[model samples]
Target: MKGGKIGESGGLTFWLASPGDYDDVMAISDGIYEGNDYLPHRYHSWMTEPYRVVILAKRDGKLVGLASGLIVDGGSTVFLEGMRVCSREQGRGFAGVIQRFTDQYIRQLYPNVRMKRLVRGEDPRPEKLAKFSLLAKRAILSLQIEAKAFHAFLSTLRAKLEHETGTGSLEQESRLVVLEEEQLRHILLDPGVSSQIELPGHMIIQDWQPLKLVESNFEVLRRRNLTWLADSLEQPTFLSLHTPPYPIPYKGGSFRFSIDLFGTKADLACRALLAHMEMVRGAPQLFQDPQTGGTCC
Candidate 1:
């Protein structure tokens, strides 16, 4: 679509994103997701992928918002990965303006595609779901494990793995390894193996389903660094380690983990378990007990 003025302000313009828009797009995303590092890398990948569409809104030459969507499920589904307006531009009707514009753009490009977005309970603006014609189909119960419980669970699981393999402890390992999809599946979904260990968190299993794969020019499984993994063909996926209460309050704080698991439940229990281990192994101090003021093992 041709770029043009968006509103009476005349300062806002909407257009399809190009390679040059990466920095501006990321700047807007950083503000919206609270300085997430994962999106920037995936945004670069998306710019080259044929199955993705990125729309950007700029106000008087500065980027103010963006909407990224992927054509998935064999071109029958349009998955809206993210949509956000900069903090300064929010509440001034920019959201609805961008949302309406993006919807029209997608309909023209993929008229038969069913649009969807995985909405989290903690999503800042739940009202935005209506813009994409997305409705609540199901609720996945996400568990928030306490620091102590998570530590204990990782300790037990690590001991079990070491005992079975006759290998040294994984605790000393400070690197993150990108597991092959099959290797991850075996490690996480094998009922006989994981059931042996007493997992600490409250047990809640979301229903599992095979994710629809869409080809991307980027190698989603490849790791750009030791600390993160991306494993999706249709959607931009990321598994990264970061500390909680972000913008890291102090130099040696406890570590936390975050991942983008857009809707498809593929061994979340295993992912969460491993994520805790990742934080412990990679950045132990971040997991320190806030009250007792003790560092993680």
Candidate 2:
């Protein structure tokens, strides 16, 4: 059913997402997360953030597909972080349809964003033991997870996903699932772990730091710094990046991303940040200012 008549199906309509659409999108998303042990819980935040384009395709008014993300790298990178057409609609060629519309819209709205990147992958931990983060397990398991294993897991999974999809989508999926850089620090704050080895059991993570596990090789902080700079300098910029040294909520020994405004155009920087700030300030309750970075992260 490649390139099947999609628009002709008239029942299909693509539009921007509304608050009312969360329930519908979540229904499918939650099912996908639960059905597969490999999937993580990042979308809970992704959906709530602004600058994220939520494009939904409805068939006979029933939601059938969802594409969500934002312009990044100073609108030079339109990251297609998540794109899913219902499994039922897969072969109907609707995925390509949504992709086309999304790509075009980004081009119109944010002319600078470059290529789209998507991610997909599996959990390296055995299904049963996947949740435990070595840092937390030290007190209980008495053995920190081999950070080397973390590196190997990331390298292998990334390579494998790229091989499988023949594109970067798999890598995108992997990033989308786990905690972002700031969220990693936030996760470390959870009071879930306290004192010594007692049992050998499957660990249930309150928040996983999978992204942090990749930062060592990815140079995420440096990349984010460069991205922040680009966004501040570019025209009609759309940018998103995580803040670092993000400590516990109350602890607050500040770690933040700083933009050297030295030669940057202040007007564009301020406007872009302000627009993003306003956009996110309107998000659902599940999202808060801290996690969303209030404007810049």
Candidate 3:
């Protein structure tokens, strides 16, 4: 908790967050995101991540604000996430103070990180949009389910879909395929796939992260634990990236899943979504909190 010249501009002392700050940071974060917050699961791990810093604000030794920034895209862009302020400090503008502190820290640490990027659940106003280039936008949907009945629910959904479509044993396997992690770079960066698949805004947005399809970014992409699927490895009609489910603080406890599909064909995208769903239904590691039946949406 090194502090002295912290938040001089806003009269709040700011410093880099450490594992010791977990309880304090989380105490103020209670009920954030309507109890579906992701920070609880990511805080500890975020401290170990390179090119990232979790900034905290304190007044008279009390934790009041928190924000984080990470240098991604080969140190060319800084992505901000998990920004929060204690309820007592909300109306006092401490949120903006911590944000500026994080920004200044990242700037000094990574002078090459010229671009600032962030993902917002709500749409921004015209003035806010004018400062940042409009990268890409996606519609998000939510669902809820029980942890004990997780696999069963997935199985039921798959069975119902197959029964309705009459694809009991064939339609999907013959149409969709998953590529090995080793094949990701070759498959995704291939001229053929790039030419065939629609790269929205010519950028790769996964988990709300915008990355350019370049060689430098491949290493970063590989770390995301993404599962890649396409119609064909040689010449793909559609592609999808699935991020396995992870825990969140929603309705007590829960897991979060994401599917990013690239293609203009509505029918093919639907098929790919179903295929991805079937692929993860049997993965036991994703949701193991049996006592807590959670939301899948």
Candidate 4:
């Protein structure tokens, strides 16, 4: 697999993943997440049922960069997960080439997929990772922050998409993700995603409250859902957000958190609550300007 010349690095290649390429793929994966923690093991499990792709960049005879992704639902959706370039090959536009090629490749493979989802971890500067002597565990938390930021950014982009399509409700147009206590327990205990987290089920939800977004000035509507939960000390709280298609005048977003009588620890729940609130606060910033679209639509 190859892409046309762009920016600095020229003549990039795109290729499909094979059983034999697992070692090389693993090598690239190690380089990408060498010290990062918090990333679920499922993030690196490529042999799963979903389709996978590996796009490699080479200059002369040595590898310079690589990209890995998966096709969900017969290529209707593409998830660009991991991407990295060699240490010596920095500063060039090779990263962009990999991204563009992956986007084009998915479109060519699955014409029905209305959109593509790509996520890059928090460490934008690969060079810093090599120079910093930070503990591996701390580095992982940094990576988690990056993952959360990426996820929140994606959520914001979904909101923008609703506005562009003239949808009445951004929440309705975008997928609503439910993270219930039962579901959280499953996620933390499930072998698939939980095994990666040492503190899986231990991270309790302390509180949950509802969220709402009233139309204000922006033509774009806000995206909120009843999918999040806040765990309380004695009970688990269910948090939900109800958003209008467009901003409601004079009324800010309204949300409710249904606290369960029987839940988890207070500190754990509060941490989760704060994280969700922060996400809600940042989500709308992407739509602050009506004239701009930031990879969401």
Candidate 5:
């Protein structure tokens, strides 16, 4: 793949990644992730995958960042697999440059695919939720219950149905209600019913619009820089970027939940969290601001 230069500084260059770039990419990933479980370990496989696109960014002949995207759902959806920037090189607007270029490259390569990613968070801070709403426009609560808990709830519902209809077990009852995934999603999203489930885990699931290349947004990001972005947030409180060994608030017990922001600002927090999600799975368009209930450009 051909390489191109980015930024007016004349130091940054970007190119499609190959297996040969694995070592350099991993070095950057290692520095940024620092043994974090969220680091991607399948760079070689991604380099060879027909539906995957990996982009590497270099500055002064040194690897500075790497990003990858994949075509999923049989070519109907494009997922950003991961992205990483060198520890020392971060906060310099390289992320926005790399992301914007990669997004455009992916769309050109797969014009027919829609872009989407899953954003999962448990009891997210109000600021984070607001930022997500600005980007995704839609969010749902996900309730994950233990199998035993779910079975108990199902059994009780089944018993009630059987009593009312004078039917046998659900397997033999023609009128039995079999809850589909959509029904569960609906129930979890419904505020009235959501609190009643009392599931072990609660998370907000954001369904973002397909990714698109917006030169204007990237240009704004580049000019203003991450520091400016950080200072722009309405609420500047700090939070931890690490996930816990287990989801918190177990059994409604008071558990100490803390995020050590280390003085990072809200915009950086938003970017870091979203970028972390991309490494594990992982938008653009005017979205409705959840806080203001107004459209965000």
Candidate 6:
């Protein structure tokens, strides 16, 4: 997306995001998502990504609001994310103004974009969002474990999985298969293989980022450091993707671990989940976080 002056309205001026606006944007985004906002981690790259737009709102030369959209699915769909407004500037309709600005900008610049998509945490009323159609709803589980106690936690978890599944170490190892980024790209691109893979709404959503099985979309997915897993390469019955834990603002030095599991095999799903956690546990010091002066995996 290009960074330039957008339309001004009622003392508010909109513009595309630039690298220098990082601090101002983060200033107003405090406490967002209860300290789990992903904007800080993705802002810089979002500015440089192709076919992606990040719009900002300013009043009297001060940044106050922000929104972003990514054009994907061969320019037929735009995924909206990272919409925010300053703490003191909320409840004044700046957020909606930013979105509407983005809407017109897409129309003028990216006429190829047709569908607009987003993920909301709360259930919305049908009358309020009549223009949008619901694709699917998901239930999420969150766990909190201190870094010092994570190993013990994993040990206990492994024991429970073993006891419930009646599987020893060797047998469990033989039951799981891990795929590389390129391999996953190849697998998803194969029409026959992807047609056979199970998905709700037939969509591949990695942590709320809806993805299409197109070559360009696959390149966008490759930007993240992820672990791909499946039951078998020849004919996979289950699939999973894991992103390494990264520091969050919850406790000042804590990390958030995320997992996206696919397929419906009850026992196989359990094995895949454990396998992903163990993969992270095996390398506790993978990524370096400058703020904490420590490593997170």
Q: Output the better candidate (1/5) by lDDT.
A: 1
lDDT of 5 at 262: 21
Per-residue accuracy of model 6 over 1-297 as CA lDDT, tens digit each: 456897887568988889988899889888998777778777888889888889988998899989888998888889999999898989998877788888888878889888898898889878757989887787776776655566777788788878886655636455777897767877778776555667656677888887777888888777778888888876676788888776666656557767888787877777777778778866555334444432232
Error of 3 at 278 (Å): 2.7
Highest lDDT: which candidate? 6
lDDT of 4 at 58: 63
Residue 180 accuracy (lDDT) in model 2: 50
Which lDDT values do the candidates have, in the order given? Answer: 0.49, 0.41, 0.75, 0.40, 0.44, 0.78
Kindly provide the TM-score of model 1 when superposed on the true structure, using C-alpha atoms.
Answer: 0.50
Q: Which ten residues in a row have the lowest lDDT in candidate 6?
A: 288-297
Candidate 5, residues 103-203, lDDT tens digits: the string is 77777778887644533334567875665443332333233343224335445654665576464543353211223333333433444432332211222
Between candidates 3 and 6, name the one with more favorable lDDT.
6
Per-residue lDDT tens digits of candidate 2, residues 31-103?
4422321112334445455445667778887778877656543445455645776767778888777777777
Top candidate when judged by TM-score against the true structure: 6
Structural similarity to truth (TM-score) of each candidate: 0.50, 0.38, 0.88, 0.39, 0.40, 0.91
**Candidate 3 on 1-297: residue-level lDDT in tens?**
322444445777777788888889889988998867878877887888767777888888788788888778888989898888889878887777777778888898899988999889999999989888887787776666676666677667667666766868447545777888767788767766665787766767887777777766777678768888877777776788887777777777777777888878765676677777667665675555564557464
What local lDDT does model 1 show for residue 197? 30
List the candidate 6 regions with Cα displacement exceeding 4 Å: 1-3, 170-174, 283-297
Name the runs in model 3 displaced over 4 angstroms.
1-7, 148-156, 159-174, 191-195, 285-287
**Number of colliding residue pairs in each model:** 7, 11, 5, 35, 2, 0
Q: Clashing residue pairs in candidate 1, if any?
A: 253-285, 253-286, 254-285, 254-286, 254-287, 255-286, 255-287
Assess the local accuracy of residue 224 in candidate 5 as a C-alpha lDDT between 0 and 100: 16
Error of 2 at 63 (Å): 0.3
